[model samples]
Target chain A: MVAHETLSRRSVGSDLRAMGAVAGKELTIARRYPSFLIAVLVWPVLLPLAYILGAKALAGPHGGSLPAFEAATGTTDYVGFIVIGTLLWGWLNMTLWDVGFFIRNEQMRGTLESNWLCPVPRGALLIGATLTKLALSLLFLVISIVEFRLLLGVNLLQGNLALTLLIIALIIPSIYGLGIAFASLVIRFKEANAMVFLVRGVFMIFAGMTFPIAVLPGWMQAVAMALPLTYAIAAMRAVVLNGAGLADIRGDLLALVAFGVALPIVGYLAFGHMARRARRHGDLGQY
Target chain B: MTATLSAPSWRSNLRAMTAIARKDFIQYLRYPMNAVFNVLQPLIWLTPVYFLGKTFASPVGNVGFAGYSGTTDYMSFILIGTVLANFITTVFWGMGYSLKTEMDAGVLESNWAAPVPRPVFLVGRTLASITITAAMSVVMLILGAWLFGFHVSGNVLAALGVAVPMLIALYGFGFAFAALVLLMRDANTMIDVSNFLVTLLSGSQFPVTVLPTLVLLVSLALPLTYGFDAVRGLLLGTNTLLPIPVEVLLLIVFMVVMVWVGLVVFRRVERRCRVLGTLNMH
Candidate 1:
């Protein structure tokens, strides 16, 4: 009876250790590729550049269309508005590709099956990768702020810094939650790039990355409201660009909090179902 | 035993290229969803740009944009750019990303060991994708016209004439990039960033005149900028940076220079990789 109990029961402490080990392993592998550092520096400036230039041309040589843009977005600083939106969207995009494809990459490397054979909870492996992604995302954010300020002459730090941090913290759960759910779907569908294009393309069109949601058609606006990034971008723009306090962004905050709570639960349920199905069917190695 | 091999000729080269293109086309058709997405993906990217133009409308049909590019038909300008940009993407992917894909599949070295000339192999890889891109560009343009009201008022054959040199020049650029992929072993970030930068700097989404002074200089230096500008000028009657004839002259000159430089660089780098025995390492 004692031996059976010991075999069946594993402590939370062991899972935590496994998570840390996986995170460290991922971090080490990431460091092996130094060129990624170039991406970290280059993307923040380059990603928003074309849109900013497009806006410049649209504003005309003498800034004639500034009135229309200012009226649509409520700020003449299209650069700030675009930068904030793309930054958050870029974070979500990276998380989707990095954490969502983690399992598939492991499978391709032939490490996933062996890792699944271990006694640790399979969720811990994913969570461990998520932790590394979070760390890298944080690094990306810091670099983005410096690069944007220097290159584009936009100040992302001019906002209420504390509120900006809080907004980032709140958006984390939704981002990773969607990523977890996405990872499971990729496992089931076995088409990683197609799935990524479909999912990210939805956000790109609906989330007002380069334009205000108010500019979208009525149905598209409805879809934008349903996405967490719409609120996150709106809230970040409000605080960072408009200098709005907590009160000005209360609605966006509440919406983000709701998504933050709901998405993770949905993600966990989806991941749990996928893990069981893969193990039962012995399909964990198939992809 | 003596084995006599057929002397290499244009006919044999053509046969080799046809075989390579056929294999790639077969593999591409095996994934129907990917083929479908190739048509949809550009439209997906264009949606925001479409809405972005809508946001800037002043009830006078993009009068502000007209001040920059000489026309308020912003979607038309963008759609033309998109059509030209599609060929650029095909060349980049066909030469660079395909090499990376072959490397990951552990077949690149074996494929290279064939008796065919290496440059022929690279060009053959692009043939299927180029055909597909052209077909999809037509469908995308039709969808753009229906959805965003994009229409071309210029001579289609003339626009194609300007585009031919630009596409050939891109082949030269792709060869150099493929050599880089051979060296780097990782292609995603490099390809993504470079592709985005090239298209953006070439004024795919907006007029290059609006760029800051330094960036505009960079834009003018890229041969693709003239390619985009001349095509848009012809199709939409938008402003061109130079006289149309001069731009065409520049593109022809660029095509000659880039192809020569590209072939030289690729041969040198590929030889270096073979010496280092790193062709199959990735």
Candidate 2:
């Protein structure tokens, strides 16, 4: 019985080591590709600056304190609103692409079959990739916030920082689950790039990443409500812009927790079923 | 040791270019889904901009956007900007990357051996891209007209007049950019960065005058600024930064200068690539 217990513990340790190895491999690859690293560091600044410039243009010479903007968004801090929206949208995009398209990337590089043959669980492999992407995305986010504060004079310390961090941390699990489910579709379809773009585009529209969902048409608002990102963004704005606390955002927090737990189970089952189907059809390495 | 053959006849060059364009069109059509997506892509991108405008729209008449852009109808203003952006992106990505794509596919050497001149081949690929982008633009305009009531209030012929010259200038700039891509031996990063920067600087979603003085100066240097102002002025009855005649003349000058510079640079790069034997390295 003691030997059996030790064997189980050893297996758990080995699984963790394999997961760490996978994540380390991804980091090494990213280091080798300097252009991609540069893009990661630079795009967050440029993309948000476009919107910030637009806000300035709309607000005229005074700043982003247009009365109409204040009426619609309930905040005169249009620059901060846009900066936060763009940053979160960028994070969502990186997560979706990095995690959802991981398998598709392997297939394109002719390594999918070998990866599937490995002893480590597929879920562990995906988790490692997601963790690496999460770390990189967080780093980029921090850098972008610093750049905005220094160059654009955006005030980053205005609201409930603890609550904002809590919302962000809670939303990540649901994003991972959604990404995993997206990966299953990619594995089934055998085309990653176009599908990734289409999915990302749909998310951009439905999630209301750049604007409030209330501005969306009624049907679109319904669709937005179903997305975990919708609640997360709303909660984030409440905390960061409105200075709302945990009690104020309890509903959204509960909804996010529900989605965070449910989606991973659904994603894992869907991926397992798709994998089996592909294996049966003898098309795992077709791409 | 024999004397080099004379340049191919103009008629032969035209025929070869047409053949290449036709081949590309056929290849493009094979993926019907791509065509459908292309038609929808602009609309997808426009959705958020539309909402953002509405969020800040003045309750009164033309006070918010018209105060800055000289047009109260933000939808038409943004739609035209989106169409122009599509054209610029096609020029940058489709034309600039054509040669690099050929090299990556291991066909650049074989294509170089063909009787056609390099300029004619490059122009053929660019023309194909222009045709596709123009179709997408038309689809976007029609969708806007049907769904959002975006009508052309100004002279249609006048708008076409402005657009034609601007397109020529844009193509000239694209040729220069294609030559630069050949010299650099990298396309992805350059194309992505330039595309983002140009889209941001061109005032596709707002008035350029609202930008900071420094950024406005940079915008003035971009050809798209003139094209955007002229096209919007003609199509949407908006005010142009400069008179129509001045804008048209500047566009023509840009076209002539850029095309000439493109040819010289492309020739130099061609010789360099031949000497270095790195045409297919990427």
Candidate 3:
């Protein structure tokens, strides 16, 4: 019994060390740079500025324009729309661009071969990195929502928002998983930055994060429907804007679950495949 | 990489042009996924049209309005602006900016060290970015027209004629932005500044006439405004909202002057960066 306990304790220690190392590396890189912080704040600041000014300038041609827009938002709070959009996107953009491009950036920095040479499993590395990003994401998420609320008053369409938070929590892992799939492609192609930028732009357009997916062209609408963010954004808008019941958002919840289940397996498989291909090409360190 | 075309026959010259274009295209092919989205960026900007449709749709309450309206079935009109933006942005971001970035990556150094004529080689990359933008714009046109009922009113060719020059002007601005990136060790500010500047100036959401006098004047000075104005005029009619030709001419002049200015400014940055040996470090 004593020997068994000792072995188990040692195993736990190793796991903790691995997780700590992965998180430590990611935090150091992101925190050391001002660009990362700058990138995080850009969208949130710009949108509020643009919308506030435009809303102010337009003035509804009559009554309190801000309130009217707020009412139009279905939440008496105009901010729910912008807040949800900005914060969720803040996570998504950071994950896809920052965390997802890890392999590519590492390759560029000439650390790929060394990183891969370690005994740690790729799964552990990715999870650890993703957790760090998620934490940072949560930090900004709070800052953006709180800051925006303080500065611009929240619309808070409905109360008891825990389930919404839960849905976001479940989806976060899957979203990073999906990003890993994209990262695998990035690792293979050496053009991750361009892809990251393009994805960021498209997110601004079709992800339903910035604007409603219903407004997209039919094809674009179809594409949006297929994306993971569509469900999250739509549910968010529905709950906030429409005071939607769970039944009304059953589809979105189900979709998020589907994404969680399917993406990790497929994305991990893809990552493994890409890692092998990159190794064969000796470009794992090419970054 | 560029090779001088001294081949004197029309067939050969055509081949050279095709080759240059092809080389540019091949570079874009290196990342099909990214290229696809680069063009899609502008189309994505049209999302504000769907919701609050009841309120936003009044921008084009006039059937003949040359201005942008979120409410009109003229989704294609907005798409025109977006497509033009995509074209212009990709040319700069994908072509000029990426080239300078590649130069720092030592790819440019290697290419320069090779015997390729600098202009010809770089132009091929530009052409590639242009191709992606063109395809994206066309896709946006079709998709936007299908969903929102957009049209080109008087003459499609006239719209084309207007758009070509305006697009040229837009690219000129892109080159200038790229030049700044080359010069500024970091021009994220330029991206932010230009991000709102082009969209706002183009009267993308409302007529310039609605802007403050100074704001209206500034919009008139930008080619982006003209791109949108010419688009509105061709498809919707300028008088429907505001004067269209004012924007069209401004864009034309801006494009012409910017092209020459961009070449000069960008080349100077290239020379300075190369000479300083700081071109390769972030």
Candidate 4:
């Protein structure tokens, strides 16, 4: 019994080490490439500015606090709305591209086979990548918030801060799960970039990143309802814009939790199935 | 006794340019799915912009957009801006990065050693890019008109006139941008930054009148601003910051200046790279 216990302890310790090593490796690579760092910093600022400027132009001297905007979003603080939306959307994108395209990147770098040879579980590898991306995305979000406040005069503090954080924490697991599922598809098809673009576009259109889902036609609303991000964004906006607390957003939280648990399991299964199929077909390195 | 060959005649240069364009066209055709994606990509990008416009649009009219944009048709306004923005992107990002791509593929050295002038080759690539961008623009216009009810009410031919000058100026600008990419030996970050800056300053999704005074001043200096304004004026009857004749003259001046600067910079960079022996470095 003691021997078995020790072995199990050793296995768990080694897995932890491996996961840390993978995450550290990603950070090192990012540090080596200044361009990636520049993109991470610049995109979060520039993308939101585009929309903010658009809103300002459209609002026509009233800035973004228009009655029409208030009627649709329940707040005339359009700058704040867009800033928060862009920050969260940026996180979602980073998670998707980092975790979802992880395998394809490995293949391109000619490291996929060697990575497969490692004793670490594939799930642990994914966890490592997801954690690193989450850290970077959080950093970007903070910087973006600062930029919006300083440059655009957006106020991010007027919200249920704790509840907003809670909603974001809940949403992240589902994003990881979706990333895993996308990574599986990318690995199987060798079309990671195109697939990521198509999926991101769908999310942008249906997930109500910059606007409310109610504005969409009924059929598109149905599609939005099916996406986990749709609920996350709604819950977040409710907490931030409407100052709703936990009780007000319980339904969205529960739905997100359900997605958080369910999608990862589906993703793990799908990845395992695809990996095995690729191995059988001897096509693991085809791309 | 050795016979010396004279510099290639204008006829030979023209022939070489046509040949290079044909080769690029054929190469592009080999990846048929990519061509489809190229056409579809702009539409995908326009979707979010459409929604953003819809979110603020008043139930009855354009929610004060008419005050700035002259036409209350927010959808058509954004569609026109986005289509023109895509063309600018094609010039700056697509054609501008073509040389970098050839270098990555290990063909730049051989191409440089060829008898043809480098500018001719660049012009050929630019022409091919223009053809592809024009086709994509047409498809986007049709898609917008059919699906989203985006209508062009004014003189289409006059709008084309504005677009033609804009394209010339953009091509001239792209040459200098391509030269910078060659010197840097990387295109990703440059392309991303330029794309964002151009989109922001060009009033692609909004009127320039709304920008901060400092930023508005900067926007006025860019050729894209004149081009965008002239095209919008003719197509949607939007108010222009300047008269159409003045805008066209500015575009022509920009075209000449940018082309001159682009050629000078390309030659200087090419000579420097050859001396440094970095032309073949990845």
Candidate 5:
């Protein structure tokens, strides 16, 4: 009875420690791979370069079609528009790969079963892994902002920096909430790559990453509205490009708040269900 | 008075290649969802591009795009590029990542121990990927046309004829790439980055004229750029980077040189891996 009381009281502190350890382990593994670091640096510049060039091609030599693009999107600054959209999407893609597959990777490496045997909460471990990915994503975003300025001449911080930060903070829960829920689903489905492709593909097609959502069909617009990324990208473009104030983006912010609150609760519930299911089925070790 | 189970003969090599191809094909089919996604993923990527092109279109056509590529049918221009890019991906991943997969499975050494020529084994691994890519490309193109209104006005047969040498050159490059994968033992990042970069620089998504001056020079230096240019020229009547005859000749020359160089580099690296006993280390 005394031991149980002590264990219950110390649980929160112990879970925090477990999360930190997992984060440290992931960061260490990331540092050991030079290719991973290279990819982090290269992809920010490389991925958007294609779209920027495509936009340039469409704009013609003397900027003949800039008016059409400007009409579709608010600004003729296609570089800045494309950069912001692709950067956020890249973060989502990275999270899907890292957090979504964290458990499956451990399973494949034969450490997951042993790790599950620990006294720590499994949710703590998943969040711990997510913490490292979250850190890497922050680094990716910083790199992208600098690279876009230096290489592409697109200054992401030209507008309201405080509002931009607020948008990022608001979207954090939604992105990772979706990732955590995706992690649970991936554990159940076992087709990690396909699941990642499906989820990210949905966002890529529906989130208006390279083009404005106004260009999408009416049905596609309705589908786009259902995704949190659509709001995130739209809000980001407003603050960063058009220098929209808080009053201008209240609807987006409110929608993000709703997603932020709802998604994590859903994620935790899904994760609980999956964890219980895995333990009951005796399939924690299966990949 | 003994029967040979394995022999180093031309006929035996052909059988070994066929077996390898068949095995890969079977393994691919085992993942039914993956097989389906393989065809759908490219289409998903194209949807955004299709929308992006629409954003730039006028009532007539993409008048701005026509200024660069001399084609108002932007979807057709992009579709042809996408098909060629798919083949490039097949070659890069087929040879490099196939060897990496074998290494991870702990089968590289045992597979190399067989009597078949090493080049045959490497080339054989790609046969399944090439076939799948070709079949998927056809489906992807048909879907692209239906969904995005893709159409080509120029000669399809002649365009394919131009692509033949380019595919051969890519296979040649794949041989050397497989040797590198064998040496490195971890090739996922390298293969992905190189494949994306090569395709990007080779005008797989847009004309090279849109690239920055230095980047355009790098694009010009790649033979695959000429391949994409010539095919687009033949099929879409896009303004060729060079005259059609000159681009075809360049492709033929590149094919011969890359094959010879690829074989030479592959032999030397295979010997080095054998000497160092690193064939089994991934």
Candidate 6:
């Protein structure tokens, strides 16, 4: 018989391949349906377009839109404020909502049970799916930025570039945690599709995506700030708008760090719990 | 020709309509859990948004530009947006999703095979959804009035008159979506398109004045915009009530046309499905 260490190494190698397979499946699906893939780009594009035109109509004559947007969140120019917000949002959307509900969608297609029988740890499959979603959303962010810069005459200002990147990078796992945590609920509840829109609708109002979460009524603002999207947004705004270093976004940066560590652990426990419960109940195949 | 085609008598058709409606109600009751969950879908939104105006610290005084948009009463503004959009949004995707549900259950085809007039039968299925919308709206409106502190200045009777045909028209537009559901197999895509399009049309994020010209034009083209505009005019005390006549007239015409078209399209699908073996769930 082979030694225990060799067996462990073999399992790890297989797990890596399994994760890649899941990511590959998501990419192929997106490629086949280019329309859906393209629409993700449209959402980010709309965010900037709303700002440029609305600001032009509303802002003081010959005084920059950049300064005004910067005063609110610390960025100058429409591109920085809108792009960073949209990019982090795109990341949050990918990691949390997008990958989380893949199982629910699979259930609807009557494919979940069969997919469950495949040889791989559940964690690998989920992580792989999250990887693919984040990849596509990042692609969306790039296309939208380039398109807006060309069509809307917007440009970005450089400031704390590395910190901005760090803030955005920290946003992923926190969001992935939230997404997986909720996806667990979807697996249990059988209403993930409906819940996705409803939950996202609530998040949009609170996340400072369209308008500042500060615009929310007081108690609601507190709730909004608690979400990972809020932290991601605040941190991005700090770098892009306030010319802030990571030091300036200590609170937001700290939040993201905690989210990165805590949320995934909590999410994994919940996801595994839900999956096991469903399997035991025999409802895993019922959908 | 032996009066064989005596043009479907109204008496029997009316009777069949009631029977079909009764059966649909029974179907709704048979799934009590779904019914409760369905009602909760809109109710869940009433709280988070309607009372969340305190976040803005009593509005920005220039929330939508021209100093006319912001208000100490921004909660009411958001309330109207969420409530009206909640009402209109449900109609489109619900009709479509319900159609998909019916098709999956074989109920759509089974009802299609019945001797009842297709319009009556389809209307019967939609009746539960329509009733649900009406009931949910009343509950939310009462809750909003009480909780969100939004007061309506419109004559209550006048608002009711406006809302009556308006719901019919909105539901009619919803049925148009429902009709197309069979033509497009992916209910999720249909839901996404309608949700996205209606969100643009409703101007929920900002005032309609802030919308780009193209989107503004499309908003006018949609039935929901007229409802939102009319409702806002009454609730917000900004625009005049004289334009209410035009909105009412357009809404009525749209209702008739959509209902007629929905019937026609739905019947065609029923026949198409009958030709294929997929009509039944077996």
What residue runs in model 6 are displaced by over 4 Å at the alpha carbon?
A1-9, A29-35, A38-97, A104-119, A143-161, A188-207, A210-226, A271-287, B1-8, B11-73, B171-179, B202-207, B240-242, B253-282
The residue ranges of model 4 lying beyond 4 angstroms of the native Cα positions read A1-10, A62-65, B1-6
- Compared with the true structure, model 2 gives a TM-score of 0.94
**What is the fnat value (0 to 1) for candidate 1?**
0.80
- Which regions of candidate 5 deviate over 4 angstroms? A1-9, B1-7
Question: What TM-score would every model get versus the actual structure?
Answer: 0.96, 0.94, 0.71, 0.95, 0.96, 0.77
Give the per-residue lDDT digits (tens) of candidate 1, residues A66-99. Answer: 8999999889898898899889989999899998
Query: Which is the better candidate, 1 or 2, if ranked by DockQ?
Result: 1
Better of 1 and 3 by TM-score: 1
Residue-level lDDT of model 3, residues B208-242, one tens digit each, is: 55565786788766666767766767766543334
Tens digit of lDDT per residue, candidate 3, span A1-287? 35553323546566667778989988998777667666555556555444333332333323233443444444434346656776676677778876777767777788767866766666677777777877887777766766666666764425438766766776786778778887888877667766776666666666765445654569987877767777887787777667677888889989998988888888899998987787688766665
- lDDT string for model 4 (A206-263, tens) is 8887888888999999999888888888887777778888898899999999999999
Off by over 4 Å in 2: A1-10, A60-65, B1-7
Report the C-alpha lDDT of model 2 over A99-203, residue by residue, as the tens digit: 877888888898988987887777788878777877888888788778878877776666888777788888878878888998899899866767777877887
lDDT of 4 at A271: 89
* Fnat, 2 decimals, each candidate: 0.80, 0.47, 0.12, 0.55, 0.85, 0.02
Every model's TM-score on chain B: 0.97, 0.93, 0.76, 0.94, 0.96, 0.76
10 residues in a row with least lDDT, candidate 3 chain A: A55-64
Overall lDDT per candidate, in order of appearance: 0.90, 0.79, 0.63, 0.81, 0.90, 0.63
Worst 10 residues of 3 chain B by lDDT: B62-71
Cα miss at B40, model 1 (Å)? Answer: 1.7
Candidate 6 Cα deviation (angstroms), residue B15:
4.7
Write out the backbone clash pairs for model 5: none
